[model samples]
Target chain A: MARRKGVESSIALADAVAMCKVDAISAYPITPQTHIVEHLSEWVNDGELDAEFIPVESEHSAMSAALGTSAVGARTFTATSSQGLALMHEILFIAPAMRLPVVMAVANRSLSGPISIWNDHSDIMAERDIGWIQIFAENGQECFDLTPACFKIAEDKRVILPTILNFDGFIVSHMIEPIEYWEQETFDKFLPEFEPQIRLDVKNPSTMGAVGVPEIYYEARMAQHMALVNSKPVIKEVFAEVSQITGREYKVVESYNMEKAEVALVMMGSLTETAMTAVNNLKAKGIEVGIVRPRLWRPFPTEEFLEVLGDISVIGCVDRAYTFGAASHPVASEVKSVLYTSDKRPQVREYVMGIGGRDVRIEEIEDMFMQLIEVKNTGKDFPIQYIGVRE
Target chain B: MEHLNVFASKLVPGRELFSPGHKACQGCAPALALRYLLKAAGPNTVVANATGCMEIISSAYPDIAWGVPWIHVAFENAAAVASGVESGIKVLQRKGKLAPGKVNVVAIGGDGGTFDIGLQALSGMLERGHDVLYLCYDNEAYMNTGIQRSSGTPMFASTTTSPAGEKVPGQSTGKKDLAAIAAAHNVSYVATANTSYPFDFMAKVDKAFSTSGSKLIHIFAPCPTGWRCQPSDIIKLGRLASQTGLFPLYEYQDGKYTMSEDLPFLKPIEKYLKLQGRYRHLSKEQIEIIQENINQRYEWLQKLSRVSQED
Candidate 1:
């Protein structure tokens, strides 16, 4: 039986992963992400989760070990945040390129400069081209639910690519919320046993991660890229199935109060909830504003994003990570590129916000909506605004 | 066990897990080490090879030399990968996914991968006590990338990066003691082997596979191309390396050190150095320095072995 309990989001996420019955977990300690692995270790020690909890020395080894486990046809998992994710930058590419279905939870945090341990998208933004199936969770419940969904999506025969489930560090991971946990029997029926197409087995010996000569290197990469691009349908099927089982609606690109709205705030992660508050406040007044959040960030859901745009003429594309001297931020750049061929090309103004765990107040989000409205009303171009930045 | 000889090949496994027709350099000792290692490990083994000579030569996509299941993830994480493979197998067996049986998980890397870049991962695997056998083929330098110096490169041994130039001799520092480092982790088994002594290396491999916890075998694999020596003299170079006490063959097991082959009187280091072009530029003084370093290390090993014997 599924039970609802008020628990820390990290604990709930750990419980969700345990429900999936992972064969191996290789993790290192880092703030915000530490609790998830800590809870997982506790479960393993308490005999609640029957899995190998490898206390890997570093994030590089963490991901490498995961590759080892996954290559051996085991359901493997790991977690990290910020610098730990940066440390895993090299292995991250290998996981997808080799088509190992390892699932990872990234407590979204800021990258180092002055060395801050706070929430941001800079860490993941740096890994935009890693080719993993990246997803964003809005809150605790989504983090819990998305854990199994990510594993299902990653381990799906059609899409044997690694997946990363990202949730805002501290904001979601450390926050206590009432999350409904799935029963093991229910989860088992939802996500079938991991039947790997290729594995490191002694009986059927084969080489993996072999040297790709120029003759086949380009083709191998293209095949991997196509697999990810074609995984959209498979991901949608899994999402639909998850929704059916849980009695909750899930979408690749979720829109809140976009109907009859002329302007909207576009972003990802827990900030979307704050943006929702701003949307509600604006709707109460005569001014119409909405929020467009892409739950599935990678393989960017272009068609669904286009459909959600509807008649919104201007959008404040909120990005927690600044691309430093680039024309626009990571999410904004993708939004612009995806809308390039589409006829309904909305004016996407880039808004860099809440970087290094700066509080993104509801008023600030409301101001972003107001700015989007201003951009819609006036036929003027505005420079990329760094929200909450002092002059 | 008495009939275990390289010349008398009947004693070893007939099935070559590392097959022929690979693009290894002529007289590549690491390749021979792989052949011998797979023979000892047999069919029930999974190898995690680091990016180096063996990986490039053995696995070039369409043509694969490895007859057993092999994975080459990156240059620096073979041990970590092997750790994962071992853990994965254990958990799978525990969950009834795989039949309960010993599947030897071996990590293979060159000196460049094992001594320097891959050291942390190797240390972590050993510290965590993963059931793995990490085999390092120490060919002195980065032989695959055209003879660049690595930490495993012997002192005063000329390499591309550590060129014996006007003001400086080749490779300023002595070779990093990787066997001692592995021993520091208190793993169940740690051994030093030379590819020239195929029987001894294969014997160590057998012991390593039988061990339950972390094990490391550091093999002295001479690179004829990198060393600029006669390709056929690889065996002689390897033998001289051990005979001259430049690279001693020993084992550390169950908190006891034992010499695999004890020499009554060590051969001159010059005899070993004279064969390889990498050491051709060394002056008598430089040779003396190299000789002194080898003497000190070998003496320390003999003392440790003596202490173990006394206990």
Candidate 2:
């Protein structure tokens, strides 16, 4: 048990937000993410949070409104999922390019026209390279912990890009959990007020968002590129600072019993909690195993992942998204490239798991260990499998 | 003669905020309007030029003809961007960061960029209540893009796309009611002017500077090449348009009306239409209908004036 309060798995984000205290909120009603904003809106209305709340119409307009308010130099936040995120796709690219340190909460859901509202990585998979710093949470506790650090990472002058804290639909967002709360005073020292370098001032008129000819276009693009690359070091340092403040350690890639393991499991988001349970069960039965969870996806923790998973034989990659017809999912493809330069490249096996809100059972994870073990014994590559599917 | 002298002084001022050697065509009314406007408004003003002929010519390469501190942002969002600039200035004024003076923010855009593409950004800026003067130099077509028709193109006017053909005889829709739109935003001052009547136009420019909040001066700048007329016929065409009551010069302040120039009496509309190749194909009946539309709109203005002065 992760400590008791209610069901030990159920805790209201609003209850936590009321404790954290935000400066501004920009929200629109979108499925799976609606519950998060509902509580936030109530607090703002009841004179509880003391934040500027902009109730916008469409997700596209909401995103623009957030950017507009943020551009005027304010600490801003918003929440959305799937189609709502898709509508905000254009501005998602714009927000980071402008280097506005906006923090957003995403309840990960399957994107649709076929219309299925379920837990999956389909929404975030599409935006993996939008130049935003993305972090996934396995539970409500991580969701609460990651948010305070989200401010630290995005606002570090070197990494002045938007950050998204993603928690799975129904799996984490809807589920209640006992989260250790931080007071407003605790957050005040950790995450300070936002102060922008170039803000819209009425007195000394200066222009922004002007079109650049070919002469200056290259330099502008280079600046944003350098900022993203330079941000990785700042991110690690901020995580270390967060560790000192809360006495809770975090890394870009969190390792769980990976030492002295032959078969290592790699996954992201809420599925990792289930995967960790499976790894522990298998370890008790004399099967050497470990789990590596990727928290930061955008600045893909390449060097850290390789350093931690050294001497591993087989690495089974689990993705919450299906990549249609390909070698595997988007995560699996990037993992392959990350291992390419390593001296001892592990036998990489891709697995598509828990898509469209399918329940990820412990039995399926146990079966995965058996398959990989059998492959190692027979000296054969493991066949790719979708963890929970009707067929 | 008194009005003419005042107008002429505005025309031949010492300083040129918008310098010469820029690429506006010979006798481009917007260029002349800039010359007259800067004289009336003075040099210590921030100009926000939109992406059009003005921007292309003035800020081409590294050379800038804008003698004062000027910015050239994108096409549709010039008004919104200007709002940012003005807002920044306002906040600075609140603090002790800026010097004390009655600062002017002039937003300049051509007909296509103003009436069509930039409508939303413009509306937002006006609604925000910025102390800014918006100048629309209406050439009635996408003249910068080789004379394509725009929302401000007059009825019966032809261009590359809206040409008089077997199916249709040039543009059928009336010019966009931009002044009315600005008036709807409840701006302090809204007016229509042309380069031909430089005095009346400059007087309104003077009024706009003196007034607070949002103000708009929509000037009918005739394009000779775009309209397929003689280059020297620019001033004559502009004069004919106003004399024929086709482009009336007027101003409005807080729902109150004022005719900047007494129309005296209307002249033949044929004189305005015949000189330009765009309206050359129009039949006598079509010309008469256009003339009637102009007369009806003018009458409506008269009624509005009566209402304003009634009390």
Q: What fraction of correct interface contacts does each candidate retain?
A: 0.88, 0.03
Top TM-score model = 1
Which segments of candidate 1 are over 4 A away from where they belong?
A: B1-7
Q: Assess each model's interface with DockQ, reporting 2 decimals per model.
A: 0.90, 0.14
lDDT of 2 by residue, A220-295 (tens): 7788777876788888887787667667787888888888677887889888888788888888998877888888
Q: Per-residue alpha-carbon lDDT of model 1 for B170-259, expressed as tens digits?
A: 888888999999999999999999999988999999999788999999999999999999999999999998999888999999999999
How many clashes does each candidate structure show, in the order listed?
Answer: 0, 18
lDDT of 2 by residue, B151-269 (tens): 99988789887989988989878899999899999999999999987778888898998999989999999888788887788889899888887888888997888776667788988
